[model samples]
Target: MKKKILVSACLLGHKVRYDNGNVTCNDPRFLKWSEEGRFVYICPEVAGGLPTPRPDSQIRGKRVVTGAGDDVTKEYEKGAQAALKLAKDNNVALAIMKQDSPSCGSLYVYDGTFTDTKKLGEGRAVALLRQNGIKVFGEDQLDDVEKELKKINIL
Candidate 1:
């Protein structure tokens, strides 16, 4: 059976971002992955009931909070759980996500000060998925993803 990959919907050109935009990629491998039918897309924030064009949030001392000081931890947790469920249900071992997003960033996220400060931390969903043993990759790490695919014999 082909191994499935959990990809961020925004990476697939979906307008499921907080700013109602997408971080679409046109990489050949991305298209190839889609052609191979191994892509399982999800927008955790959207799945967790957050609206499009919603307020931008960041990781603030273990809690997710909007720039305006509104708490969105529950929503982030809900989204994280939803992402995990989707990955597990589809038997996914890999995920390619957006960078620097509070919901999908696998590398680093805002430090909640909203002054463009960044910290070395994974987003809520990325952390949860990693805890579940899913190898998460940032969009810039597609080459590393290919390496991982070979490790799992999915390439």
Candidate 2:
């Protein structure tokens, strides 16, 4: 049996991206895992009541703020909390988040400049997961995630 793994909806071919588009990697390796029912797709932003093609957001000064400097941290935090709940409900051990997303970003995110400047930024959901002792992995780290999952001995 395959262990549950949290995944960003966009990466799983869902239209939950920031631009109202899907980040469908459609990678054979990921698809195989999905076919095995190991994936738990999520969209933290929408789960927080935000809409599709929503305004780009980022973390600034330890808060999840929007490009306009509005304090939307509560929204993001709520989303994070919800994601955690889902993870717990599904008994997920590993999470694959979207790269460079304000809600799902795992490794790289914009510099909050609303421009094309990307720096090391973590989404609110990612932060919450780490704090709760859950193993988080960015999209780029799929290989590492796979290796770690393999060590779980859940077969």
Candidate 3:
């Protein structure tokens, strides 16, 4: 069986972002992975029951709050948990996440200030996945992802 790879839905061209838009990865390697049926895409926020085109949220002191001041920490947590469960269930070899997002960023998340300020931190789901020993990377790291896939004999 091919090793499954967790990937953010938006990166797979799913309209799952806060604005209902996707930041699809155009890298040929991504398409190759898709064709090989190695990608298991999920939108953490959507899995947690948040709607697409929802208000933009940022991590505010352990809580995820929307720009309009609505506390959505619970939703984020639920989403993160769901993501972790999926990863474990499928034995995902690794993850390709969207960067600078509240729920999917593996390398950076927007500051709570929401002024486009970025901070070095893992997103809720990425943190949970890491805690459970799942390797996660950003969409920009497809080359690195390829290396991991090769290591796991998925290439």
* CA-lDDT, candidates in order: 0.89, 0.82, 0.90
After superposition, which runs of candidate 1 have C-alpha atoms over 4 Å from their true positions?
none
Off by over 4 Å in 2: none
Candidate 3 local accuracy as lDDT? 0.90
Native RMSD of candidate 1 (Å): 1.0
TM-score of each: 0.96, 0.91, 0.96
Number of the top lDDT candidate = 3
Off by over 4 Å in 3: none
* Tens-digit per-residue lDDT, 1-155, candidate 1: 55799999998899989999757978898889888999999998888889998999988898888889899899889988999998999989799988898988888988889999988889989999999889999988999998999898888
Ten contiguous residues with the weakest lDDT in model 1: 21-30
lDDT of 2 by residue, 100-145 (tens): 8877777887787777788886788988888888888888887888
Residue 10 CA error for candidate 1 (Å)? 0.2
Query: How large is the C-alpha RMSD of every model relative to the true structure?
Result: 1.0, 1.7, 1.0
